[model samples]
Target: MIEGGALVKNGHIQQQLNQQVPDASDWLALSLLPRLGAGRLKQWHHERRAWPQQWLEALSVPQRHYFLYLRHPQGHGQVLQPMLDWCTAESSRALLHPDHPAWPALLNELPDPPLVLWAWGNLACLEQPAIAIVGSRHPSSAGRHHAQAFARALAEAGSCIVSGMALGIDAQAHEGALSAEGATIAVVGSGLDHTYPRQHRSLQQRILNAGGLLLSEHPPATEARPAFFPRRNRIITGLSRGVLVVEAALRSGSLISARLALEQNRDVFALPGALEASLSAGCHALIRQGATLVTTPTDIIEELGGPWRASSIQGAENRPACREGGERQRAGHDPQAQRWLVLLRDGAVSLDELVLRSGCSVSDTLNALLALELAGQVVMCGNGWTLSAPSSESGAQTR
Candidate 1:
C-alpha cells in the first residue's frame, strides 16, 4: 500500500496506473513528432480511431520516411517512455485525453485544444464552474489585493479560481481560493516536475493538498521558456467561464489571456485602477475595448452568471462544519496554538508563516499544529492550517 492507504501496485487500480488507455501510447508518440500539432492530431483522432502507426501507410513517401525515422530507439526512449512513466503516478497525477471523462469540455471551444493534458492533484475540480483571475507579474499592491479579494469571494461562492500560478496577481489569486477552501487550478507553462518560478514550490504543493489542480499542456520534465508561457495563458482562459484582469501592462501576458477569453466567447472583466498607475494601463485599454469594468466580485459573478455572491463569509468561515464545531468552543487556547491559529483566522497559513509570525521554532510549531489537529481545532488545508468549521454553523451560507 502507498502512504495514503492506496493500493497502487495491484488489482484494477494498479492496472489502470500502469497502462495508458487504448491508442494513448500512439497519441503520446505522435505528439513528439515534428509538424504534427494539436489541430492536426485532433483531425487524425476524429478521422481515424487508431494509432499513428496505422496512418504511416497512407502518408506521402517523405512523411512516411520521417515517421519511420522517429521510431528509432533514441526517439522512443526520449519521448514515449518518459510520458508512459508519467501516466503511472496514479492518484497524484493523470494524462487526460479528449475521451477521458475527467477532461474539461470547455477546452473543446479552443481552436487548437491540446491533444493531451498533464494534470496533477484533484481532477474533479475540472467539473466545477471556474473563473480566471490573471494579471501582471509585478502588479501594484492594490492590484494584488483586488485579485485576492475577488478570488476569495468568488471561490467561497462556489466558483473554481483559475490562474497561471505566476508570481504577482496569479499567486495571490490562487492563495485566495485556497484560503477560502475552494478549488483552484494552476495552468503552468512548465512540466509539473519542473515548476517555474521555483519560489512557488511550496505554493504548488499547497494547491494540490487543498484539493486544487495543476494543469499543463507540456509533457513531464519539459523546461519552461518564453514561448510556453503564452500558450499556457490560453489554457488559463479556456478553462474558465470568465477572465478577470486585476492589473496588467499594455503589453503584458495577462492581456493575452483576456484576448483568448474574448475569442472563446467567455466574459472578460477588468478592474479599473488609478490612471497614473502603469500597472493599470492594460486594464484601462481592456475596458475601452468593452471588457466589463469590475468593482467587486459580484460584478464578475453577475456578468458570468456564476454562483458567487457578495455577502458570503469565505476563507475559514466556509470550512465544512463538524459535530464539535461552533463559535462557543474557542480554539487556540494555548499560547503556541494561539499564535498559529490567529494567522489562519483570516485565511490559510503555511508552516513557514506560522514560524515567522509566532517567532517559534519550527519543531515546536509543528508539534503544536499536530496537537491542534488532534483536538480538531485546526485542519491541514493544502500546505497550510485553517480553523475547522464549528457544529453550530453547520449550514454554511455559500453558493
Candidate 2:
C-alpha cells in the first residue's frame, strides 16, 4: 500500500516512514528549495524510495547549493528555526510528513499534494469527510449568513467544514462549524504561527480549543501574502470531497478553488444569488458551467455521500456540544447509538446495567452513551443514561 510502504505496482510507491527519516531541518530545507514544487518532489520520491535524505543527494548541483545555504548561519534560519521550534515546543504542534498517519489522505488525490503539513489541533479531523466552503473575502451580509448556516448544518450532519480562515466568508464558515460543535479545518495561507486578518487571532485559539484544525503548507512565522492565498486555494480544495461557493465575484479566489476542485475531480457546489448581486456572479457562472446548485445543507450532504449520509446527531441546535475533542472523535459515525436507545426504552440505566441489557461490552455501552449524549437523544442522569428533551413517543432517532 502506498500509505503503508508496501508497493502495489501500478507504478507503485512505498512510504518508508518508519524505517529512517532525514533530519527535520533537512526535510524542511528540501521543501523550501527554489524551482521545486511539491508535485515534482512527490513524483521523484515515489519513483525511488529511501527517504528524504537520498532525495537531497539526488538534487541538481544548484539545488544542493541552495540547500546548503539554508543550513548556513548567514542564510537566515529565520523561516526554519521558528517553525522547528514551534513543533518542538508543543506536543500538539506537528509537521506532518506525507506518510504520517494523521495526514489528510484526500489531499493525495490532488495532482500536486503538499509534501508535509504544519498542523495544529486534533489531527483526527483530517480523516473525517470534509466539505470546503469558500467565498469572497468581502462577502455580502447574506453571503456571510449562507456560509455560516451551511457550514453549521453540514458540520451537524457530520461533515467537517474546510476553508481558508480569511476575513469574510471563510471566517464565518469556521465560526458556524464551531457553533454546531462540528469539526472544521482551516487551510491557511499564513503560517501556523501568525494570523492574516489579525482580527481572527481569537478565532484561531477557539478552533484549537474546539477540536478543529489549523493547517499550513508554509512554515511557521510565514506571514500572509497576496500570492500565498491563491497558491493555498488548491490545498483547501484538495482536502475536501467538494467545494462550496457561497458568494463570489468573477474575479474572486473562491472561484479559483472551485476550478481546482473541478480539476481534481472533486464536486463543486454553489449557492446562487440574485441576478444583480455582483458577489453572486461567480456562483451563477459556476452553476452555468455545471457546478451543483445547493440551496441547503441537505443538497450538499446528499451529493457528497458516504459517512455524510450516515445518521448523525439530530438537530444542530439541540445537542450538547462535545466537551472534548477525543470524546467527539470516538463518538463519530456510530450506528449503534440508535440501538443503544432501544435498550434504554425501559428508562434510565447505568453503564453496567446497559451492558447487561444489551449484552455488549462496557466500552461499547459507554461509547453508545456518548454518541447519544452528543446527539441530544440521551442525557446522563445521576451516572446513568435516559432519553433527553422533547421525549419522542415513537422512540425513533436519526442516525
Candidate 3:
C-alpha cells in the first residue's frame, strides 16, 4: 500500500507508503525531469537493457557543460528529485502509470501515450466501446443542444460518451448522457483531484455518481497549463473508436483531436453547421476533406457499422419516450406536447399541417411546441418538428 498526502480513500488521505509493482512513482519521477519527455524516454526504454541509469550517466557530461555555460546552477540529478516526489505523492491518489494492468490497451497504441494516467472512478469502463464528442468550449445554444442530445443517444445505445469535459459543448455532452441515465467518460487536462473551470465541480460529482469516469494525465497539484491540453486531446481521441467534432473554430483544439484520430486510424465525423458561422468552419473543413458528415446518431452508427447499426439509430429515436418518463421526468407538459407526440406518430408533418391537425391555435401551438422541445420530446428537422422516435406513450397505447 502506498501512503502519502496524495492517497485518498473514501475522501480521507492516507499517511503510510508501501512499495508497489511497476513503481509508477519512478516512471512519473523520470517523466518530470527537466529536458526528459515521452520521446526521450521511449528512446531510452527501447534502446538499452541497462537504460535508466546508463542514459542518465551519458547526459551528465553535456548537461553539466550546458548548465555551467548558461550560469544556471541546477544539476541534472537535482532536477530529477521533484519529479520523483511528484510520482510518490500522486501514487497516494490512485493515479496509475501505463505499467499498471488497469491501464487501457487502446492508449498504448498512440505514438506517444502518456507515461501515466490519473484516473478517478471505475477503471473498468475503459474497456467499453466509446465515442469521443468534442466541440467549441463556448458553443452556441444549438451546438450545445446537439452535443448533449447526440451523446445521450449514443450512451443509451450501450456506448460510452467520451469528451474533454470542458464547458459549453463538453459539459452538455456529459449532461446529455447522464440525463438519459447513461454512462459518460470525461478526460480532463488537469489532475484527477483538480477540476478545472471550478464551475463543473458539481457536474463532476454527478458524473462520478452516475458511474461515469473522469481521467487526467497531469499529476495532482498540476495546474491547467497551456501545453497539457493538446496532450489531453490525444487521449480523448485515443480512447474512442471514433471522434465527433460538433462545433469548432478553424484553429480549435477539437480539430487537433480529429487530426489525431485520423493519424491513429480512428473514424472522424463532423456535424455540418451554417456556412456563415465561424464556429462551424472547422467542422466544414473536416467534412470537405473527407470526414463523415453526421446529422444524427444514425449517421454516426451507420458510418461505424457492425454493432453500431441503423437499428441503433432507431433505438436512439425511441429514447425520447424513456427520457420523458424516466426518474428525471421532463420539466413540464403543454398542449403542444400532446400535439407533437401525435405528429411524431404521423411522421414528419409540415408546421402548417401540424397546426391544422393538432387543432390548437397557431400561437398556442407554437408556444406548446417550444415547451415540448425543452422537454426533449420533439426536434425540429427542416421545416417541422419530427416526433423524436422514442415516443413517451406505452407501446400498446402508441399502436
Task: Using TM-score, give the best candidate's number.
Answer: 2
Candidate 1, pairs of clashing residues: 210-382, 325-390, 325-391, 326-390
lDDT of each: 0.72, 0.74, 0.68
- What ranges in model 2 sit over 4 Å off? 1-23, 51-54, 68-82, 310-399
Candidate 1 lDDT tens digits, 1-399 = 112121222243234334333345544555555665677656665675344334554454555444443444455566577776876866678888787788899987788888788899998899889999999999765566567767876887789999999999999899879867899999999988997899999999999999999999888879999999988888999998899999999999989889999999999999887778788899999999999998766667666663555444323232222112222222234343444455667767876777788776553454455445544566655446677775112212210
Clashing pairs in 2: 5-15, 311-399, 312-399
Q: Which ten residues in a row have the lowest lDDT in candidate 1?
A: 1-10
Q: What is the TM-score of each candidate against the true structure?
A: 0.70, 0.71, 0.71
Q: Report the C-alpha displacement of residue 297, candidate 2, in angstroms.
A: 0.6
lDDT of 3 by residue, 316-346 (tens): 4333221222232222432324535766665
> Higher-lDDT candidate among 1 and 2?
2
Poorest 10 consecutive residues of model 2 by lDDT? 1-10
Across 10-91, the per-residue lDDT of candidate 2 in tens digits comes to 2211232234555456567778888777777777656765664466556766776666556544443555686678888987
Error of 3 at 362 (Å): 22
TM-score for predicted model 2 compared with the true structure: 0.71
How does residue 115 of candidate 1 score in lDDT? Answer: 77
| Model 1 misplacement above 4 A | 1-22, 46-78, 306-399
